[model samples]
Target: MTTEHIDDSAWISDKDSPVVARLSQLISALTNLTMETTEDLQVANYGVGGHYSPHFDFYHVTIQFIRRSCQIFCFRSGNRIATWLTYLSDVELGGATVFPMVDGYIVPKKGSAAFWYNLYASGEGMIFLRFIALN
Candidate 1:
């Protein structure tokens, strides 16, 4: 399976607009996570045949160590514990989120969202919980 990493064209914060603020609030409430623990909102646009290869949302052990050490002094949140993906548009053709390990597949629909845990309750990354997107 080929892999591709495309940076999001836009990144919006809650403070940038009321719409994003409301979306952030909804994400927080749904995930049961505080705003401080969440990252800024990202918007990615995919054209025909676009795709995202399988990947994990949480950091690796070494990166987690560095991040945790930094967080001790910087007072920032640790590695990602969960992901809440909100679909802003519907796809007429192929656009689906897939989790191969667990045989999970989610079709894109406007105003719909998918949520999943990336880490265990003990803060360890769930290795089999990787996902991919086909567009």
Candidate 2:
């Protein structure tokens, strides 16, 4: 996976990027949440040595987000929410995105995407969102 940090306000630009832009818009539409609430929606490309360790999406509560979220409650209650993950490219092997629960696994399809949501809440009654690419 290739990782690069950017300023919080950096705009993403790339050819054939409309799918991701649409996905982001859909995310905003699906929930009352806003991306601005978080520092930034950092984007990365994963291929080799790119697996993400199991972790929570949000580090802590923020006044900009809801105190509790359907995401958390659904996860803890054994329910599932819809999340959208778009792949920028294809890999030969070992790059599926995996979640510890329900054996969540999605293969990379260039310009395609997957959707799922977390159902667990945080200690402070907050919601979390996270994902990783296995490479």
Cα lDDT computed for each candidate against the true fold? 0.78, 0.52
How well does candidate 2 match the true structure in TM-score terms? 0.49
Over 4 Å off, model 2: 1-23, 30-39, 60-83, 119-132
Error of 1 at 97 (Å): 0.5
Per TM-score, the best of the predicted structures is: 1
- What is candidate 1's TM-score against the reference? 0.81
lDDT by residue for model 1 (1-135), tens:
334654344878888989999988887777678877566787887767777777778777564355555556335656777888889899999889889999889999998988888888888789888888888
**Candidate 1 deviant stretches above 4 angstroms:** 1-3, 6-8, 62-77
User: Which window of ten consecutive residues has the lowest lDDT sum in model 1?
Assistant: 1-10
TM-score of each candidate structure, all chains considered together? 0.81, 0.49
Candidate 2: C-alpha RMSD to true structure equals 9.3
Pick out the ten consecutive residues of candidate 2 with the lowest summed lDDT.
Answer: 1-10
